[model samples]
Every structure is written in structure tokens, then in C-alpha cells.
Target chain A: MTTRLVEGSAVVAEAMVRAGCRFFAGYPMTPFTEVLEHMAESLPRVDGVCINAESELEAVGMVWGAAAAGARAATGSTGQGLSLMQESIAEAAMAGIGFVVLNMARGQGDYFQATRGGGHGDYRTPVLAPSGPAEVTELVADAFELAERWRNPVVVVGDYYMAHTWVDLDVAAAVPDPPPAPDWALDGSSGGTGSAKLVSPLGTTKQRDGVGYDLAAHYDHCAQRRQAMTEGIAPRAECLHTDDADVVLVAYGTMARYAEAVVTACRTEGLRLGLVRPITLWPYPSEIVAEACAETKVVAVYENNAGQMIDDVNLALLGAAPVVGINGFRTDSSAFGIAPDVTVENLTASVQALFEQYG
Target chain B: MYHRRVEREILFTGIGGQGIQLAARTLAEAAIADGRRAQLFSSYGGMMRGGNSDAFLVVADDAITSPPVVGTAWAAVVMHHEHAAGVWPKLTESSLTLINRSVVAAECRPGTGAVVEIDALDIATGLGAPVAASLVLIGALVGATGVVSADALLDSAARVLPSYRAEAAAVNRRALEAGLATTNLGHPAWSRAEVPS
Candidate 1:
């Protein structure tokens, strides 16, 4: 296998292509822009179509159209751009459209936006928050698989760190086993036949000649599918020193790496600090979070934003442990702009102060 | 010096046009070529000529889990005096710092790390590639730390050069060799890596 140092966005796009993502459309946004750039360059080379849509709304609509036509498709933007696509995303979820939506976010401000979305309905999308470039490479294929498996939009959340960083990766290694076929997709083969299919935001009814609208039944089916996903897709997480530790720090995305390193260093210095990094942010990794917090005294939820994911952490713990929210948001005075102060030293100080009072 | 399974962070700092990002990338790619894990991050301002530009690189034998912004760098390559002030404070006492004597007017604090000042611009100009002063310092980085072999660095540098700029490849090679000849690898403050048991 040939190893090459590559930008994370380029590698992630390659992995998506390998995982059978044949259609991509996105608008330019910082951090997320790189992914779109790579997709535009590489997708057409693989006999796939990549579009630089006029806006985020157009991008998601394009991806929805592509997914409806039986191609594994994707679209993404920064969290700000994602806000504009919420209606389309919710529609896709309700309609059982399977595709990947990437939130190459600016920071961890959008945990609630990704997990508990603004979509108006009893709908939830599986969100994967990868901590670094390597994880992004691995999760791209899994995101696609999970999307198709549930026939719902799967959101992969990352930030500037994951986007701009260059790491050594072999994109080939990231392609998981091919997902099952989309037999239910819209193909124009049986257009005139009575058995011709219909794909819509309204759930399909057993009527070929008449327009059947069954709101109550469709809602029931959507609820049931969401329930099945909750049970079938086990939450994925990484636990370090959680089994026997006094304190457990809950973090995700790029902030998770900062916490991980600080935990290792704290352990070296005899603090008994551990970390719980939720790889799959929704499904929320509640079970793993609960398990890691079982024996710990204090659970610190560190996020780059102003205390978003702490709610999920608190809900997961179910008052099993006291939770403290550590806000680590920081903005660099550069053209690169704002980001979290996700340095190991900064995190270590936060941990030490927490221990000084609560140890 | 170098030890396997441990993370080493290097910060490259200079003005916007100084090739700081490329130098950091070269070290990172060289480490990867030698079967090591590496991550390179670049943060720069909007100004294309004279603004603070920096790049952070983490090299490790195993996966590097550190955030893009490092707390304390193990090593640093300073290319200009303009942005060096802010960089000095982020370094720990044991940081292995190399300054471009051709540009930086004052030396770093005497007690901080093992400071190696090289006239990189002068060296590069003598080799007929003054713009490749960054490569010269990168060569000194390999020589001082032995993090990766000089040959590995040269190969990576050649590979990373854009196709349109291929004409300067020979001079860039010469600059790296000259920088290597100027530095003595002994008395390195940074830990050298060996395969872990």
C-alpha cells in the first residue's frame, strides 16, 4: 500500500468516492470548502458528478435529487450553511432518502444542531463526529453505509482542525465493505407498468393508479424506523482509563483529541482522569457515556461551544455523576479566524482546577 | 534523541511569504515517508506578503492525538524576526529552537532550549536559490534532530515542489546539503526515536 501525506479533505473525498459516493454537490464555506473543492476535482475523474451549487439550499436539494435517482450522493457545508438545508434534510429523512450530509463545522457549536436538529418532526439523524483526519477517513465510508442502511441522512461532523490538517493516510484502507443495493431507488424501468414505484417525502402507499395520502400511517412508519435505528445502530465511542478513574471527561470532534492527550498526561501525573470520546455523536453514545461515568465522581463535558453537548452528557449520566461544563471556545486573530483553544495545556489546566475543588 | 511511540511537535513561524507552511509540510511528509505518522497544520493571515504565518506539525511513531494547536513545542524553526516575539513565549525551556541569523536580529533567551542560529538566507543565496531559505533551515532541522534522514527530506522536498516550479529543484537540493553541512547533530536537546519493544 502506498502511503502519502495528504490534506484531510482530499483523503475524505477519496474515501467517499471509494464507498460508492457517485454524486456530490456543495457550496463554498471555510473548512467545508476544501471538501467541496476536492470533490469537484476528483468526483468527475471517477465518472461521478460534483456540483458547485449556487447556495447551500441548492446543494442539499441537488444531493436529494441525486439520492432519489439511486446514486450514493453527498452534500456538505459549515454549520451556518447547514442551517439553510435543515428543511431539505428533514424532508429527506421523512421521505426515506439515503445520503450523507457533512458538517465541516467551524467549532463544536453545532452539537445540538447535528444531534437534536431544528427539523420539525419526530426525526433524528445518526451523526458521526470524527476527531481528526484519520478518523474522518475511516468514518466517511461508515457514514455512507449507515445512511443507506437506514435510508436516512447521516451527518459527519468535523471542524477546521480536521479540515485543514494534513496527515498520512491511504484512502484505499478507509473503504469499508460495499453497502447493500438500493433496490427501492427510483429507476425508470417500469414507468408505464402498474408496479412502477414512487419516492416522496410522503411515505409510499400501495397505490399505483391513485394518489394515496396517509399522514397518520406515514408518521407511524417514520417513528418505527427511527426506533429501529436506535436499537440496531449501537453507539460507537472510545474510552480511556474509564473503568477505574475518579473523573471522566466527555468530549467529541477535534476537542476530543485535546482531552485525550491531557488525560494521558494527567494519568502520568497521577490524577486518575479518563476520557470518553463519542465517535458516533448521535445515537449519542449514551450507553458508553453511562458506562464510563458509572464509577467516576465528576463528569466534565468539554465543548468548544457554549455548552451544547453537555445536555446530552447530562441526560446520558441520568444524575449518576455531577456534570461540569467547560467552555473552551477561542478565536485566533488571523484570516483563519475563530476556533477552540483546544490545546493540551489549556485542557490540563481545566482538569486540574476541577480536581482541586472536586478531587 | 528520538524515541518511538512518543509525539514530537514542531512549530514553524515567519512572515507570510517566507515559505513557513511549505517547510512544515516538508518535515511532516518526510516523517511519513520514513514510516512515521505525521500531522501538519497551517494558520496564516490574509496578507500575502508581510503578516504572521505559522504552521504546526506533530510527528510520532504511532498515531498523533494532539490538537492542531500545541501547548508547548519540542522544536521550532523561526524564519523571521517579525513574528518571532510571540513564538518565543510558547516554547518550553527545553525547546530545540533554530533561528535564521540572516533575518532575526536578536537571539532567543539564552536559557530556553538549545538555540541554533543559521544564516539560512545567505546560505540559500550562495546556492542561487534565495527563496529556498526555508529548505535550508529544514535541512538544519533534520541535521540537528536526526528526526528523519537528510535523504528522506530531500526526496520529500523534491516531490512537494509544484510542477511549474520544477526548475529550482537542483538549487533546492544544494541548499539542503549546504545547511546540513553547516550544522553538527551532536548535543541535540530533542529526544531521538527508536522502535519501541
Candidate 2:
């Protein structure tokens, strides 16, 4: 219940402790390094274990091991390190062991492709994107809950901006109880059975069949759980004046804040406009967005990436509104796809042009 | 009923750890304390040390229409040469430019309006803390623009530096006085200079 001027990284750490995260394993990576440092200092105060893993791969594996042993475990890294941890993440996914992975996204490319998409498979991990300090705190709590409820890994994705920015937050109320390991978790002893039963290996025919049947049931249950999560955990999308507007501005994260300002300005000038901010990027609140598009004339998607979220917006709108993308990818040819130097002024002009065209 | 108008937009630019953020925050807090609606936003990049840092502060009696200042600012306090030059184009004819005399060397023109030069480093060192140069500049800003009252400035300082209340309070008070005392800019014809080259 202590209130202090905590940095964004420190806020995330505090949320982790509140969520009953007892085990932390991570490697040092810029921007994200602060999270590890904060955990190293605070976790021990709460009688939790914090391990500085030798490598990113080892860090994820350590969390996997800890979770299997019935402890609330977590790990974090930057883009490159997250890439190295993908193999272990996939294994954890298959095992249905609940754990949390934080990706403080930075420059994207060969050395740091994990920020973009480097998990080595087609699975879309339940990813929560937080723009500022407040969202960071709220999402961390949501991520832990989602992880434990589904018995799978929940990733809280943040960029350099969210990691470094300092914003005021009040988190004395949202802390959860200490996580208890389920009876099914592997804790080295089989309930009163003298003989050890190995449930991991799937090479033998009988073992393979047993594992297949169990995995199939788990996957089916997981599918239904995921659907409920999508409907239940869908982020509250902010729709500003979209009901009777002709042009809708679509944005998320920090960019959405700037777009909100622009929309306010445009409205003052007598231009009819509104904004749709997708708070949850993973669940991709398509239905909510489609409802907005039904009444709007045109939709413009503004993002820091080169059309990463536009595809999803297009799918949601489904030709109900003419969709245009105003992308801001780094044009410097740097490996990191840091949004090319686009300012609010640049975006204002782009929106103005759309307004004139539609008018 | 009389309609109120937005008075001004000001930008404070300097390197990280130079107290630019603090100065901006104080100004906004002071405006709010005086019962005015003020909005502040800052943009800082990878350069924590010796890197380019800038903060925008907008103050008005009414609600702010936009979060960021769009064009020319009414006044600017530049602590570094690069930031001053980078933002030189955004000055209006009546805009006031406060340059740290220790670092910047630029001739003021008619279009760019008045330029106030002060050796903030010297004044801060004399006050026994070189880091207080920002406070000196802020003090000079209050005196020059009359944006906020001197009493408001001191109140803002106390609120921002609450942790260092006992130790640095006296020096900061003196620094503000020094800023108000030294106004060496000769009156120049106010003309809006063409955008900086």
C-alpha cells in the first residue's frame, strides 16, 4: 500500500510482486534492463527468488522449471534475447505451464528480431501492448491473471517509450494473493505412489497415445478458454465522436494519444471525425471496430510500424469503410524499425488531407 | 460576457540532467497553482547524457485545444547551442529568446525580437551550485515575460524540490533573484524573422 514516485519499470516490478510472482529469471538488455534490476532489489524483500540467468534461453527454461515446480515464475528480455528464449517458450506452451514473459521491445531486425516477431512458430501468444506507465501497471496484472487462468504464457509487450517514461500510478489496491501450484504440477512425488510416473516423454506407442489424448483434451479446453478470454478480456476501446462522424482515425499505444489531440483540433475546425484506439492488440477487438466502421465514411490507421496493425483493421472493417494507412517505419535503413521521424505535425497534415478528400 | 484568449506557448530545450524537465514542470505547476489550465509534454531520445532534450509547455486561462504546441512559441529558454539552433525557426517576431551566455553566441535580429543573454554558469557557480543555472534562467524568464508572479515561482520551486527543501532552498531563492537582476538585452525592433536556415 506504499505510494512513491516509481519509474515505469519499478511499477511493473511492483505489479509482479502483487500478482504473487515468486521467481524471476532474466538477462540484461537495455530499456528492459531496469525491470530485472528492480526485481533483483524488490523480489528478495518479499522473500521471492530472483535469478540472473546465464543466457536468454536459459532464463526462459528456468522459469519453465520453476513453474513446473509449482511456483509463480516470470522472465523478461529485449528483442534479441526474447528470440533466443523462443524455443523454451514453445516448450512451456506445449506443457501448459503458466508463466509470464515480458518483452520490452526495441529495434527490430537480425540482432533484435524478437521485437517484431521471432517466436519460431505460428502461434499468436496472448500479447498485451501498454503505452505508458498506467497501462503498464494494469497490463502486468492482467497478464498474470490470463497466464494462470489458461495455464499458458502471457506476454506483456512494451516498447522503449513505455519502458523509460515516468508517469504517476496508484497500485495499492490491485495486488493478488500468492499463487499456489496446482496439484497436477510436477513436484517430484506422485500422490502416495511409490513408483515414479513419467508424463513428458512421447516416444513409446502407449506413452504417445496417452500424451496425445491428454494433449488433445487440453487443446480443446484451451480453445474454449481462449474464446471466453477474448470476449471477457477485450480491452475497452475508446471511440471519440465516431457515431455520426465521416472519417475515423485508428491508432493504438502512444500514437493514439497524439491522434486524440489531432482529432480534437480537427473537430474545432468543423471537420467531423472520431478516433478508435485498440487497447488490446492480440484479441484484436474486431467486432467493436466493425461496429464503428459501419457508421463511418473512411478509416485511417496510424501506427509506428509499416502497416502491422492496418491488416487487422482492414479485416475488421471488411470494406465497410475505405481504409488508409499512415505508416511511420524507420527510413534510415537501421536494423531497428524505429518509426521513421514522424511528428504530430506530420500526422496532423495527413489527417487534414483525408478530411478534405472525404468532404 | 467576455471571451478569454490563450496567452502563449513556451518551449524549454536543453540536455538531459540539465533540469529542463524540472523547469518545465515547475512552470506548469505554477500556472495551475494560479488557477490556470496548463499542459506540458516532453520528448527525450536515446541521448540521456549530452543528448538532445526538449519540453513544451502551454498555458492559458481556458482549456488547451491541443496537447503539443504547433508553430511559433511566445518564448523559449535554450541552455544548449544545438537546441537553440534546432528551435530557432519556431520563434515569432515578439518572441523572447533567453540564451545561456556561457554556451551560445548568436546575434539577435529584428524579426527574432529580443534576446536576453546571461552567464548562467557564472551566476550559478557564485550561488555555490552550478546546477542551479536552470533556476536562474527560469527566474530571468519570470522577470522578462511576466508569465508568472515571482511568488508563484518560489512556490513552484518548493513543490518540485520538496526532498531538498532545507539544503537548496536558500541558494535557489538567490538564483532567482540573480536572474531577475541581470537583464542585458538592449531593446531591438520586434520583427518576425524568416524561418532559420
Estimate TM-scores for all models.
Answer: 0.91, 0.77
Off by over 4 Å in 1: A171-181, A191-195, A206-212, A335-340, B1-4, B105-111, B126-128, B189-197
Window of ten residues with lowest summed lDDT in model 2 chain A? A198-207
DockQ of all predictions against the true structure, Cα-based? 0.61, 0.16
> Largest lDDT belongs to which candidate?
1
B30-82 per-residue lDDT for model 1 (tens digits): 88877788888887776899988888898887877777888778888999877
Q: Give the Å error, residue B95, model 2.
A: 6.1
Candidate 2 lDDT by residue in tens digits, A1-359: 43233456787888789878999999998667889999999888878999888988888888988887878889988877887888777656556677888887752222123223455433345666665566676678788887887766778766555554443343476445686777756788875555443323121112344444455555555556546655666555778878878888887766676688777767777788888887666667788789887877789998766566787788898888899988745632222233434455677798889878876
Flag regions of model 2 displaced more than 4 Å: A1-6, A107-117, A120-122, A170-179, A186-236, A329-341, B1-10, B16-49, B55-75, B88-97, B107-116, B142-197
Candidate 1 residue-wise lDDT at A39? 91
| Position A160, candidate 2: lDDT | 54
Residue A352 in model 2: shift from native, Å? 1.0
The Cα local distance difference test for each model comes to: 0.83, 0.69
Instruction: Report fnat in order of the candidates.
Output: 0.89, 0.09
